[model samples]
Every structure is written in structure tokens, then in C-alpha cells.
Target: MTRARTSLLPYLLLAPSLLFLAALFLVPLLQTIGLSLTENGELSPANYQRMVGDLNFVPSLRNTFVLVLVVVPAQVVFALAMATMLQKLRLGRDIVLWIWTIPLGVSDLAAGLVWLAILQDRGYLNSALMALGVIDGPTPWLTYETPVALFFSVVAAEVWRATAIVLVILVAGLQLIPREYAEAAEVFGARPWTIFRRITLPLLRPSLQTALILRTVLAFEVFAVVYAIGGRNFPVLVGEAFVWQTDNQNTGVAAAYAMLVVVISLASTVFYLRALRTPPEQQP
Candidate 1:
């Protein structure tokens, strides 16, 4: 009875947080899913069928997949490189880390605006190219109806804004790794590349896996950058969902879109976890 009471105490103490999550997250999510599967106060499969045939819905899914696929890897690699370099440098590390994290403080909307200014016609990029005689005239950046250009602009904005987050996670993970392992590898005449490939990367996998899953999940829901740069014509998943809810006043469809976002995020997270499963020896 005493042991049972002890266990119950912890759960009782945790009851508020669990209830809060259920109220705010789980309940709303279940409600959204219910909404997507119903129409006109009736349980109908029309929502799912419509999403399959809808032009915008399919494209939004594709755009989200592309955005996450490109941005997650790009952001992780850039963050890893930055973290590795930062870890190696002995002097001014504090200052550089502070500078790197400055971007995290900048709002996504603000970052998009900053990049829009630089990439616009007659903007700094064009001005510099012209001054260097690299181009004859101002080049159209946001004007051309190219998906690649649209994606690149979105990626550039997101990377600038979110790279610091990944850097911080990686740096913290690196700190957790004992110095003795690296020293041991060095004493055994292990080259830098070998040490990194075998020791550093293996030890950092848990953190990297976490960062990748988080960034990928966030990337799928990206809105501000595409909205600011590509506008409505080149909409991603979240932006399209917003349009469906606000512009079209289609709550059912919007809920369907929201459910799609949740599905995509959950799928990506599962894939990452499966792919990054630790070896038995490394398992906690």
C-alpha cells in the first residue's frame, strides 16, 4: 500500500500538466480529426475524397515535402559544421556563440522582410552584381514564376532565422561527450576525420536525430517565409491551410488540411526514429 501510494503521489502531482496537455493539445487534435471526417453535422467521407481530388491540396503536400526535405538537411549540415568549428575553437568561443544565437532572437517575419529587401530588384545583390559587371541589369528574383527560385528563397530565409537553434542543440550535445574519448583517439594516432566519423558523430547521433526531427517537423509547417516571398501563388501547406480557413471560410477543409499537417509531421518523425535507432550497445 505504501509503494502504491508513492507511485500515485507522483501521478497526482503530474495530473495538472497531463490535464493541461489533454485540454489544449489532445482534445483539440481529436476534435480537428473529427471535424475533417464530418460535414454538415454528419459523418461523411467527402472531406478525405475531396482532398484527394483537390488541386491545391496535392500541391501543398508536395511543396511541404520538398520544403522539409531540402531545409532539414541543409539546416542540420550547416549547424553541424558550425557546431564542430565552434567546439574546436578555443578563443572567443563565447562571443561567437552569442553572435550565432542572435538570429534566434529575430522573428521569422522580420527575417523574411530583411531577406526580401536584399533579394528584390535593385536590391543589394543586384547592385553588387552590377557594380562588379557580373550582370548587365537588375535580375528579377521574386518576379519569375519558378518553383525552384521560390523554394530557394524560402530556404534562405528559414536557414538564416533557425540555424542558431540547431547550433545550440548540437553544441550542448557536444559538451556532454567526455573529453577523454577524443584524447584516447588522439593518443591512438586517429586522424581528425576518423575521430569525427567514429567517435564524434556516433556520440552526437541522439542530439542530431532530435534536431533533425524538430527542424523537419517545423519545416513542413513553414508559412511566413513563403507568404512574404512567394505570396499566395506559391503557397506551402500551412499557408494554404490559412487561406482555406480565412479566405474560403471552409472550416471542414481547413481542418482536413490541419490533419494532413499532423499526419506528415508524425510520419517524418517516425521515419527519423526508425532510421536513427541506436545499436543495442549504445541503447540506454
Candidate 2:
């Protein structure tokens, strides 16, 4: 009996977490899937059909993909550079890092509102531009007619708000990398860029994979920031879901849109897991 209990120790410890996952994620997920696929007490694809048929569907999907493709890569590059710079710091590093990550404490809606204040007509950005003689007066940038500018505005706010998450993850991974390897490479006349390319990147694959998956997932789920900045001018998948649920009063269609988001998130995660997979030889 003692040996059996000892053998079950790890699983017993995991019991609460498993229960929490079931209660919080799995149950709701099953309900959503059911809700999305069923109609009048029968399983059907009518909700999905309705979702796809909505006029906003194509624009929402395109905008969501565009945002994810643009934002995730930008965030990764910026965070990686920031993390590398932070790693090179020998003094006041933690203080600087803490300052850098201050944005992480800001909620998504609050961050969006913060930027909206800057980007809106007659907002700080326009006032600064006018003062600098860059513009004659307030210009409407966050309008449907200015799609390109609105898109970029949302991108800027998202990067400012969320890049800190990737930075922290990469910093943790960089610190775990044994410094002796880098030093040895330096002694062998390896250049800084080469060391980063051949040494740092290869070792940082796990962290890169993690950051990519997380940021990509969030990018797909983007709603609040875009809503605050561009509103209906920039249609995204999650925003469409919200519109369906609240504005359209269509719960099934909203559930369908949500399932689509979950699918896209899962697909991106699988891509990263496979593409940036760590070799057994590289495993720590």
C-alpha cells in the first residue's frame, strides 16, 4: 500500500490542477463547442454557416490574420533585441528591467484607452504634430477611410502594451544559458553576431517557441485595443464575436466565431511547436 501511494504521489499532487483545468477550461470549451454546433436540440453546422455568411466575416478574418502576422513577428524581434541588451547590462539591470516591464501591469482596455487618448483627433499626437507644424490641424486617422493608418495605429498600441511579456520570457531563458559557452566562443574569435546567431538563437529555441505561441495566441484574440482605437473601422475576429453576441444578439454565431479563434490559436501553437522544436541533444 505504501509503495502504491508512493507511486501515485506525482499524480495525486496533480489532482487539483487537473480538476481546475477541467472545471475552468475543458467544461466551458465543451459547452462552447456544443453551443456552436447545435441548433434546436440537434447537432448542426448552421451557426458556422451564419458566421461565415455575415458580411463582416471576411473582413474580420483578414484583419485578424493581418494583425497577427504583423504584430507577433514585430513583438518577437523587438523583445529579443531588448532581452539581448538587458542581458549585456552589468549594473542596475533589474531596475531597468522592472521599469521596462511596467506596461505589463496595465490592463488591455486601459492600455488601449491610453493610446486612444494619444491617437484620437485633437489628441496629444495631433496637438504635438500641430505644434511642430507637421500638420495644419487635427486629422482623422482612425476612420474607415484611413484603413492603412488605423491598422498601423492598432499595431503600435499592441506592441507597446504586450512586448514586455515576451521580454520577460526571453530574459529568463537568456539567464539560464550557461555563460561559459559564450565566453569560450568569444575566446575562439567568434564575433558577437555569430555568437548570437550560432550560439544564442539555437539555445534559445525553447523560449522563442514559448514566446511565439503565447504572443500569437494573444494577437489572434485581440479585441479591446482595436475596438478602442479604430472601433468598427478595423474588424477583427474576436471583435466580430463580441459584436455577434451583444450587437447582433446571436449567441450561436458568436460561439462559432470563438471556436474559429480557438482553432487558429491551436494551429499557430502547433506550427511553433513543430518548427522551433528543440532537439533532444539540445535539451537542458
- Candidate 1 per-residue lDDT, tens place, 1-284, comes to 99999989989999999999999999999999999999999999887777666678767778778777787788888999999999889999999999989998887778888888888787898899999999999887885466677678878888888988889999999999899999999999999899999999998888888888888888888888778777775767788778878988888888888888899899989998988877788666
Model 1 misplaced regions, further than 4 Å: none
Give the poorly placed runs of model 2, Cα more than 4 Å off: none
Expressed as tens digits, the lDDT of each residue in 18-41 for candidate 2 is 999999999999999999999987
On a 0 to 100 scale, what is the lDDT of residue 65 in model 2? 97
TM-score of each: 0.93, 0.98
* Clashing residue pairs for model 2: none
* C-alpha lDDT of candidate 2 relative to the true structure: 0.95
lDDT for 143 in candidate 2 is 97
RMSD of 1: 1.8
What are the lDDT figures for the candidates, one per model? 0.85, 0.95
Q: Give each prediction's root-mean-square deviation over alpha carbons.
A: 1.8, 0.9
* Poorest lDDT segment (10 consecutive residues) of candidate 1: 142-151
